[model samples]
Structures are given as structure tokens and as C-alpha cells.
Target: MQLHDSMIKEIEKSKDKIIENRRLIHQYPEVGWTEIKTAALVARELESLGFKVSKGDVVISSKARMGVPNQYILDQHYAETLALGYSEAELQPFKDGFTGVVGEMKFGEGPTIALRFDMDAIGLEESLSTGRGPVDKGFVSQIKGQMHGCGHDGHTAIGLGVAESIAKVRHQLNKGSIKLIFQPAEEGVRGAKSMVEAGVLQGVDYVLACHIMANEPFGKLICGANGFMATAKMDVRFKGKAAHAGATPNEGNHAILAACSAVLNLHAIPRHSAGETRINVGTIVAGTDRNVIPDEARLKIETRGANTAINAYVKDYAYQVIKHAGLMHQVETEIEVVGEAVGGKSDEQLIDIIGSVAKRLNVFDEIVASDDHAGGSEDFTYMMSAVQAQGGKAAFFMVGASPDGTGGIGHHTSNFDFKEDALVESIKLFTGIVLSLL
Candidate 1:
């Protein structure tokens, strides 16, 4: 009881900082690998908190990265972020699109516990309507076409909050070292493998990560998810000859039609008899004007399945669709696997630990082990599997936050928003887990 009180008190002391960080991140949402602004702030805060910070190529291996933005886009975003109030010195560590931070506190001879926090937003416009989103409060995403639709802004805030909370109770942490891992590009499930390949959890005994609002109402906690599907994100581009549409329709091989065909056929992919399968060509861009045939078309696509084999099956078949669709249209097709993650189940023991800790905190109306299927895939599974392979335990918990007044808003949408107080709830959950382990 005394220990729990101490941790809770520490978290309460810094709760304001948590909310402030959340709002700040919400105001300047960065997408995927272009999280320079957010990462710089994270690095600065962690350093101020006295944790040893790692950045740039130090945290992620270069060759292992997938689905990263092209060099030009990254450079432009970095400059824009710098203009927004980040120092070149602070951004230096992650210069050239290598963004993400890992902060570590080492205790003499205890277990190493790692907490992963993804810090990237999805590409979507945020609602400016009063009460429906942050517009009324002036804390809405300032970046156009990018918003923290998945609650990662809140996740990043929780990471910083946990750092401050635990820093207050450092003396009690005599048993283990804590690592706060801030990952990027989790939207496309693109970041974790790079961190894993860079040896982020190399010697960790326990790894825990969480997300906000998996449809659970406020005050409830889903201890962790199982059945997290394996997934692959692919970038497909088709090139063809362009000509005036009306002047010489046959002279042009329209890449847009080829892309449309691919989209239709990709959806027509046979569902595996073994389990579930999913695919979506989320965005397609082709044609400069209506008068001319589009010579180039690009698509953002993703596939998911119950397990690796199933995901692989869909991925292979997707490539064939792209190939055949282009061949059928006489266009040159190019596709690259930009990101991928293998599915896995959470360790029951780790889930048990989270449940017991949550129970002790008394922060929840109901604490339940997640029987929920993680309807989507997460790159964190890569980190979890890596740790478990070395005999470590891991759990990815879910924190609930049902937005007030508005109906349930699904994630990855413009209207997606959550209760601000959920930041404190997340901090408490993480602190609870940290105390249990250390």
C-alpha cells in the first residue's frame, strides 16, 4: 500500500506536465518517419529528466528500415520542423529521417524493463468543429493533412509522464533499469523491427507497450491483446505512356486504369480458409489533369492475416495482382515491401502481472484480461517477439477513453479524439507495471 501510494503521489505531482506534453504533441502532429519535431522534444525532455538519451542512427539500424519516406520529403519535413521551434542541435541526432528516442536509467544489478511508446501520427485532416475535436480548445493539430488519430500523441505524453513519475520514486527502483522507447512510423507498422534489429530490447527481462482507446469506455482497462495479426505494407507504382485522352486514346497506356484494376483485384484476393485475411489500397494517386492520360500512378497498400503464413499468402497474391493488372494494361509495374510485422500472442504471465498491478492501483472501474482480438496489427509485436525469443516476458496493454458528448469515433479518422484525462490514467497504468517489475 505504501509503495503504491508513493508511486501515485509521484505521478500526480507531474500530471500537469503530462497534459501539457499531450497538448503540445497534439498541436504539432508529425507523421511516420518525419517525426523530427516530436522526437527532438522527446529527446530534450528525457535528457532534462536525467535519462541517457539515444537518437539518430544510434537507435535504429539503417539497412533494416522499410517503407520510409523518400529523401526529398524527409528533408523538407525536417526543415519545416526546425522552423517550428526545434534546434538543429537537438535534431542532429536523428538527422536525415532517422527519428525516435530511447531513454535509459540503469540501476546497479537489477532486471531491465522496457516500455515502448510509438510517437507518430496518421495522415488525416483533424476536425476543426467546436466540441467534436480540439478546435474549440485551440489544441488541435496545426499540421495540415496529419493528425494524431491513433492516440500516439497521448502515448508519447504517457511515456514522458512515466519518466517523470518514476524519477520521483527512483530510490524505490532498486531492482531494475527502465527503458522508455519512443518509436516512429507505427501507423504503417514500420518502426519496431528497426528498433529490434538495432538491439533495443537486447537484454530486457520484460517489455510492455500500450495503446489508448480500443473501444473500451473510460475507467476500464484491457490488460493486453492477443491475436495481433501479422501485416505487410507495400508501395506500388505503375508507369505508362501519356497522351492527350481525346486526341489519341490508344496512344496512352493509362496507369490510373491499371491502378483501379489492381485495387479491385486486390480486394478480390481469396480469403484464407485457415483464418482471417485483410487488404486495402488506402490511397491511389494518378493523372495530372482530366485532359491527359496519367503516365504514373502510385498506391499505398497494406495486407493482414491471422498469422505470418496467411499474411504472406495475401502479400504474394497482392504482388501478382499488381503485376497482372499492369501487364494487362501494358504498363510497367513496380512494387516494394515497405513494412511488415509477424503476428504473435501476448505472454499470459505478463498479462497477469499487468492485471495484478492494475488491481492494486484501484484506478479502474473494471480490470479485465484482454480476451479482445487486436483487430489490427502493431509493430510492437516485433519488439515483443524479440524479447520473448530470449525468454523475456511482454504484454501490450490497452487503455480506454470514450470521448465525451460525441458518438464513438473510430481511429485513423479526422474526428478521432479522446479524453485528455486519459493521459493520467495511462501514466498510472505504466507506473503500476513498473513498480511491480522493479
Candidate 2:
């Protein structure tokens, strides 16, 4: 069945409201897991739409804070972490605020369909350039050093618009249930797994999510992409005796040398010809003094590929590199797997559904069916895995939000931004998906 013209027209009428929400969210950007303010706004909006909203753990509530050593002292020590370069400070807040909201609209008895929207922003500052026009004329993030450079502002607004529009068609959706999930902490790739564990898809029969594409031009929507890369984030540490470098060099096992060797070998991991693979050592810290032998060294590494096998292969190789590097340097080592995401493939059946709906709505030209291997990973992989395990089909679509001919900046970049019109189209596309499924 085609999306009713009346429904499309109604969505068109709400475009202004959608833009307003986008701007409001953009102004008060919140980072992953620390989305308390964003959550409050989302919950309030959902409640206003007459949907039953549950807060604090039922759907989206703060997780218990980690019992780190000297919690109170650590909190005071990292008070300035909201600053751009002080990301480690932001981590604790994210851990504490990492929660999600699930809004459900019931229709007649039918298969349950779920729609997810990530609500967390990245830690990059928005560009203040006047080139993108007036929408960004005075758009500066109120929170210092935090901004929605990743277009999640647009995504959250689109989700709300879809939620509202779908509610308007609740009478016609009597055949099935549509669930709206506002997930938090996507930037660090940590939120979706928790939501999945909380049974967000307990009765879910199908799932769909959309992300704004920065490189694509406005007015276009990408229905199917090859898939996202499977990725793992790891922390590696080396321990050694600390001794004065000038007076007792032989007394310390040099942890810095071990860590450096591991970093170099990590890049030597072979890539598979079957799909893309990547390894990067993003951070390294060691040593307390220049005149002393380093007592400890730490490294943050990430591995990714288009599929699970390659991803696993690289991760295993990474572990070996760290182990041998420590052995070679005579420094004890520890490796911790901090985060992971399985690669995802869009189902052809669902891709076709999105394409057809876009066509009927006269937005088909904006939809492209192509495969992309993004090295970046998403926790949404967990949701996809959970749903697929239950024999449910899933698709993650990409919506273009970049102005024509301007790639803007890549995600996580300080200059990352997008066009507003794409928000309206995304809402309509998602709303149409709910209607079709019902």
C-alpha cells in the first residue's frame, strides 16, 4: 500500500515545527551518555504527543555510576572535563547518564516494528562560518566546547517529527505497533548495547534506524548501504618499575618502550582482501618524569572491518602484538576490551520497502541503493544482532543533510554540519515506514 497523500501533506505542514526542534536541540548539545537535558526534552515532547512515557530505567534512565576509586575525588578532579581536549573527564558523566527512551504507539494487532534515533552529540565545536547561511548565523552551542557537529540534533528532531506524525495516523496503524526509541551515547558507541540488554526489542518484529550523511547533498536520501564496519575499542597498559633515569636506569623496566613497540606493530596487522580493515592507536600516555624510567604506559587502540571474521582476525592479531611487545621489553602488560560492534548488512526486502516509499512520495531521486564500508562502528550493531537473532529483518538507512556541492566536514570534525530540509524528509520517510509496516 502507498503512503496516503493526506499523510504526506500533513508532514509537510509540520516542517517548521521540525526545524524548530532541530535548532533547539542544536543549541543545547549534550554528549553521549550525559544526555540528561536532551532526555528531559524528548520525554516531555513524547508525553505532549499523548504517548505513554516512562523515565529512569524503564526505557531510558541513568545507569548507576561506576564505582571507581575515590569517586568523589575523581568527580572534583575532572570538573573541567566538558572542555574539548579533556575527554576523559566526560567519560564518567557518560557512564552515569547513559540511558535511552522507548516510546510505543499501538495499532491493531500485527507484527511489531521498531524505529530508533540516536540522541547524543559529539564533542566537537560547531563551525561558526557564515557560508552555510542564516540557520547557523547565530547558532553557537550554549555549552562551551560541546556541540552537535554530528547532526544528531537533526536526527533527534526527525525522530520526534516521525513520532508525532505516526501518532496522527494511529487509527490506520491498528494492524501493528510502532515503537520509537531515542537512544543516548551513540558518539562513544556505548548506548545501544545497554538499550538492547534492557529488552527494547523484547517483542520487536522489525527494526529501522537512520543517520544523516554529511557528504550527500540536500534533498537526497540513501536507502541501502553495503553495511557498517565491525569494530572493537581496546585499552592496553604496561607496568614497569619506576627509577631515576639518570641515576638508576637499569633498575626500571621501561614501559614506554614496550608501549611504543606495540603501537608500531598494531599497524602491521594484515588487511583481508574480502573486505576493508583498519587499526589505529588513538592515544598513548606514559611516564611521570623525563629523568625517570617510565613506570607505566597506556594505549587506546581500535580495530574495524566490513564483516565479523575480518574484524575478529585483526583483534586477535592486535592482542598478539601487545603480548609480544611486552615480552620483548620485559614489561608486564594488560589488555581490556572496552567496546565492540558487529558489522551490519541491510536486508534487501526492507531496502526495497524504503525505496518504494520514497518513490511514491516523490523523494525517490534522493534515495540511493549502494554499498559503503564505513570504518566507524555503531552500537546499533547490537540492536541489529538482537533483532536478527529473533528472525526479525532490519535496515539502517542514510539521509542526506549536506548542502549541494558542499561535503561540509566529516563526522567528529569540528566543522561538521548539515542542511535543515533533510530533517523534514527523514521524518516523512520514517513515518511512512511505520505506516507501511502497520
> Can you give the TM-score per candidate against the true fold?
0.92, 0.89
The TM-score, computed over Cα atoms with residue i paired to residue i, of candidate 1 is: 0.92
Clash pairs for candidate 2? 60-100, 107-174, 108-174, 108-175, 220-366, 221-366, 226-371, 226-372
Task: In model 2, state the lDDT of residue 392.
Answer: 94
Q: What is the lDDT of residue 108 in candidate 1?
A: 61
Q: After superposition, how far is residue 241 of candidate 1 from its true place, in Å?
A: 3.2
Tens digit of per-residue lDDT, candidate 2, span 1-438:
446888888989999889888888888787665665666677778878878765446654334211122445334423534453434432433334544677777766889998889887776656676665323466667776788877888888998998888778776545878788888767656667767777788778889898888887766677866568888888889998898899889988999999999998899887788988999999999999889899899998889877888999999999999999999988999987666778887788888988888887786455686457655777777788789889998888887777654655477766677778788788778877777776
lDDT of each: 0.86, 0.76
lDDT of 1 by residue, 1-438 (tens): 134676677777777788888889999898888898889888888999889999888889888788888899988887877786777788877777789799999866878999999999998988887875477777888888998998999999999998887777776556679999999988888888999999888999999998888356888788878889999989899999999999898999999999999999999999999989999999998889989989999999999999889999999999999999999999999998888999877888889988888787787887879755787888899999999999999888887787762327688888888887778878888887787777
Weakest 10 consecutive residues of candidate 1 by summed lDDT: 1-10
- Candidate 1, position 46, lDDT: 90
Report clashes for each candidate as comma-separated counts: 0, 8
Candidate 1 stretches with Cα past 4 Å from truth are 243-257, 287-294, 405-407
**Candidate 2, superposed: residue stretches over 4 Å from native:** 60-95, 133-136
